[model samples]
Target: MMYKFLFWLWLFIWCVQPKQSIAQTLESTSQEFLIRTISQVDFKQLIEKIKTTHPLIAPSIEMVRCIAPTLSVWCVRYTNRATLPQFLTALHAFPAVTDIQTNHLLTKPRGRLISDPLYTQQWQLVNDNINQNTLDIDIDAEEAWQINTGGYTTHQDTIVVAVIDEGVLDSHPDLTHNIWRNTHEIPDNGIDDDQNGWIDDVLGWNFKTNTNNVNNDGIGHWHGTPVAGIIGAEGNNGIGISGVNWRIKLMSLVKGQDEASIIAAYDYILTMRKKYNESGGKQGAFVVVAHASWGVDSLKAADAPLWCAIYDELGKVGVLSVAATTNNNTNVDTEGDMPTTCTSNYLVTVTNTNNFDEKITGAGYGKQSIDLAAPGFNSFTTLNTGTYGVFGGTSAAAPYVSGAIALLYAMPANRLMDSVKAAPAQTALRLKQCILAGVDPVAGLQAFTVSGGRLNLYGSIQQLSAYYGLHQSASILGSLNAYPNPIKEHLFLKVSLTGATRLTIQITNLSGKTIKSRQLGTLPQGIHRIRLEMAHLPNGIYLCVVQGSAGRQVIKLIKK
Candidate 1:
């Protein structure tokens, strides 16, 4: 009789649970809604039209505001929340509206918080075999620091990274020296000194209230401070823990817990970066990396097209965005997570790992979507109250990658830096390639991320160094290009020469079997285009070795 009663009780609870969840979702959906409209539609005129058409509910309409003007995204709020369903149905019928989504609340994943100040406790930077943890599971930051200290670049350009979250405590003792300041704008002058449209954004703009105050609230808005510290807290300081880049600029792009505010913050970052690129890096900030440690869970890219599209826009201006996957253990590929699932080549998605170099049980993973993992569990970092604390989650994982990118930019390679200035987009893609190619392979991440590895700062620096060494011309070879790489019948090869030398081409398979060999004797000092017919070669991978007077360079080719 007791077993029968327990079975009925289980059934009763299961049936009632979903009803409660449904009611909560319905109540939450009634307040605000986000809509994407056609660009030609005047947003203010539409708001007036809605007020005139809905006479009875017009007085209850709280506010209508533009979120992303370029994307034509707007937020509509109503005081009479019960009318949202009908209002949504009515708005969907309009031709100008392309897509709509319930304005879901954006949140940072909560992590276990603890207070610790000793650098030895920061096992994420360098493992010391404490508390039965694995050694060498860290990001190899110490070794990378030997190569570049994340301070100024060889050209002495100040590298800036934008932290898009609630807000970063710019006054934090460890972070104050590294915080980015807009010298062009005057403080508290109530004027747009820089003429960037934002009034007196001396530090960074706060999109939550459209103000210059970008400090974190002492409430649950505690994620951004640690994130900024992780990216760039003043290193070698005797106060708290060290960040990834010791002498880097951290720009605080404050956001609210909603999509509108996040989009607006991105707009500010985009404008500043575009200005930097257009003005020859004289006026605006040199923001190469942007870190976003907060996002919506279970949100698909299809529903949030405008949000996903911003990553590409940021990339064109030479900014690489790093996003943390949801803290949930579910696979992001199957369940879908925003920004991670968004198909943008410029965006690097990271997941969380622990001190043991293992994916934490609570962290999200996706073999196809996630790029790599980082040490995020129990990471010792700076806090909003000018103290230190241990924070965990994918939120703590992403900034490590962002910092690594900034450090790579500081490497003393003039050739690489010139390439970055000439072709910002292409160089940004190359930077992403270096990071993905340099990750340390981890057993836990083998089936989880595209890199199948965890972040290794030293390995990435070495990879970038090797790339710079390989591309070095010694004043002989200017450039080498191969097109239609995955070839069918013919391959086009272009070689730029600064001096006369015998040019030889050799094609070899992976097993070192020479498939083709040719010597075009005594080329002049100019660009030479040659065609090779690979119609007889089978569908496989081959290496095209180009030999010149200076040295030999290898280019990987595919035939299909």
Candidate 2:
């Protein structure tokens, strides 16, 4: 009896132990599944999905850094006469030349000069007859006007815009004036001049080398000079191309393509902002904008945390972080990309458009994420050695907007305030309006971007100017409110005027068409309530203009 009982107990123990081992293995397998399936999922996409499904997420503006530096050169040539065969043969014979093509003058020499070796030419033609004036281009003119009209000749503001990518050609004539100087630390002193954790950041810091070698090596992908040219090329210098905002100081925080270096560069920008603000210097407004023109592919969404954190920190300090919308052509709404994908409210995400007002085929798009489009493809700008090239990508587009922001900041008291107040928010809103108000209603907002409707710089400037005027007056008026802002029902207007005056109310769509207008009788001083019935209006965003003796104010109202 004892032997039989022992055998049964041993068998039971063996059965129970194997089952327990199998269960443990299954639990271990489940844990591994969690790491790969759940933990490894794209955080940006998950956050974006939540924001879309859940309004509480309130995904705000995010500055994306997406443009990669290109080592290739671009060149163009002009002939004494129209001779395609001779030109092609000459171009092909050139040692540095790689590709060549002809323009409309193939039949006759009357047409405009054409770009040869389109992709990798280091030199380009400057037709003396063909309005080589940069002002002829809409972007160049807009930038010039933004600076000249504002009367901001001196660099008194001294705001720093950090370029985090390849190093800058520190010696470039056009960029030398605006390059940041570490005043605290002396240059070439072999000491940590400013003692800001850097040995020598004379012009700007380079994290890639962990030193102050800001020189453009002409190789190794330090394309910082071109990026700098976009942000603050010295204007009216009679040399090279013009920058967007020539007055602002530019700081270079160089970083490699690695994630760690990128994070270090971001931290460096924040640190400088903090140190500058703490120093009690006249230029208290330090590092107002950061330009990042590179992005990771959508498949690498899991690795966007560092960029997202940098973007978030920039927003916290009132720094307007600008990022490229990417040249990947992926739907940013669905897939995730760093810097741009990180949904931070203070960031201004920019995509690329071509000179013809059409979205570049490769420019990324999204209704929820992408803020606006700017000139990108076949655009000409300053290159490395006091030269210029025609490069394409959202990278170029990002700088155009960056320069525009600088110009807006330079406007007069009223214009400056108006521009600064609404530039960030309006950038996002205006982009949405431009995209939504497409030529084809069927394709809706999506088709309008790339289907031949490029970025309208002239129109954007006009809109920004008008918006600035409206916002400035509204600030002074005070105590004015519009209910049902995303109007799904009858809209309500409440106003508190300081003095007795007649108020005129007008509602118009983006097309400048007056949808509704009314003259309100004189109202007694203090708060008064007025209502506009818009239940019959179609579903779209409308701008409500209120004109009084004070000034005109415009507010966006959506009719759902």
Candidate 3:
């Protein structure tokens, strides 16, 4: 009974707003609807005609609310109570109106909440023990951190991840430090400083109200904070959780209760990326990836083309959009799902997996449409209202890819990314290739996803490292060794660095799946023996990676 109820609830949520933020909509409930008119329609004349012909509702050209000048769509609001169908027929009677659509409420997923120290509890970062449960798994996040902290220093501007959600906790204790700021446009000036069509978009623009005020997550809905946190929450702060890009700049683009608002948000991301490239990175955010964990449940929507084109549009301007597949446990390839099924190279659909390395019963799957899976069940992340919780869903799964992509782009050694940035047209495809090439293959996933594996940040990093001729560039610890080959559950590491140095050691399977990771900060230069307990590991061959500031060393290990 519970399984049936949960399935029904998941389907209903997927069919409706996808998340549960509809009841918390900040948009006026005054029966306002969106209409797309012919491009040749006169803006002033249409307003006059609507007011004279139909007195039931006040209609106006949404110049401020709608950013696309090329799009002929105009938003309309009802004044007095009237039948929706009556209003639609009255408006469509005119030759100017081309199409009419209602506002689709957007939502985010919720999960069980708990408080615990990070690293150990977050199984997605590093799988603790060798258990038979395929669920005891992670994305090798800890090992990825060893490659570069999100605070990694690059000569260029900070990497920006555009989070198109309800809104983010602008003042969250863990998020405030890493939030992106528009230095080109000064705050509270009441003037268009940079003149990017916004008056004072000191951070990012809120497409719903079309204002500089982007504070939307502090209230009822708590999606953006956790989503953003998963992407790039401040790292090493001794505060809250760690994101994929700990030092990344998070830009919040507000999602509204309507399609127009969603469309406007994408336009904002598109505009910013163009400006950044056109100005040689002097202005606009260095937006590499846009995170959209929300989308239609199915591809049956008549306006699927309109929505699918968004990924292509962003891809054209050098931005990859990591979107979530439906949370409902159904094959999107047959029944079909929107945005996921959208044939855009820039769209990377992520499914969910619990700690068991197994797909959750409620998450969606597709052999051709879905790209990959990530740790989504009970992902520990930041929440709205300055709290922390576990947010579960494909929504939570997508940001893992977002953060991983951002880390690659932000890293200094990424030559391919550097080349791709020079040409925006190839950005989407190249980024997709770079990411999918490094996944750890799963046996049962062969027919479930395109990649047939889960995301492996360390593996991707190594690929880039080899491509850039930086692989094994420096071996700070000379002739390091691990004791007891083919031993069971325990190993000792011998270090030989020049002086006091911080080292990170990782034990990974041959497929580059990280099995264990340890962060040893600042040790003496002389030979020191470090004992590691790897109990519960099943018999297998594995690789041990020892990384330090100067260089990295890899050794093969076996278990019996």
Write down the TM-score of every candidate: 0.63, 0.53, 0.65
- Residue-level lDDT tens digits of model 1 in 1-560: 99999977875554444433433564643355677899969866766777688776666565577888899998766555455444554564466876666665442111111122466678887663555667457877765654467867677888999998878887788898998999999899899998899999998988888889887756667878989988998877667877888899999988876888878888788899888889888888889988899788999889999998999999999999999999999899999998799899999999999888889898889998999999999888988777898888999999899999999998766477788788889888988888998898988789999999999886676577666632333656544546555566888776655457888999996456788999999886544668998899865556888998775767777654
Ranking by TM-score: 3, 1, 2
Could you list the CA RMSD of all candidates, in the order they appear? 30.1, 30.4, 29.7
Ranking by lDDT: 1, 3, 2
Candidate 3 weakest ten by summed lDDT: 107-116
User: Which has the higher TM-score value, candidate number 1 or candidate number 3?
Assistant: 3
Residues 1-560 of candidate 3 have per-residue lDDT tens digits of 99999977765444344112322231322233556777867745766676677655444322213324589765554433333444444555565665555443222110111122463345566553423324225666655554466543255667889999878988988789888888888789799888688888887988877887787557766788889888887776677777777688999888787778887888888888889888878877778888888878866434577777888898888889898989898998887877788878888889987776678788889998899988788888888979787888998888999998888765557355566567766855665776787787887677789998888775666555545423232443543556555455678765554345789999886456788999998775444568899778755556889888776778767655
Worst 10 residues of 2 by lDDT: 28-37
Model 3 superposed RMSD (Cα):
29.7
Q: Model 3 shows how many backbone clashes?
A: 9
Candidate 1 stretches greater than 4 Å from native: 1-117, 217-220, 470-560
Candidate 2 overall Cα lDDT vs. reference? 0.55
Against the true structure, candidate 2 reaches a TM-score of: 0.53
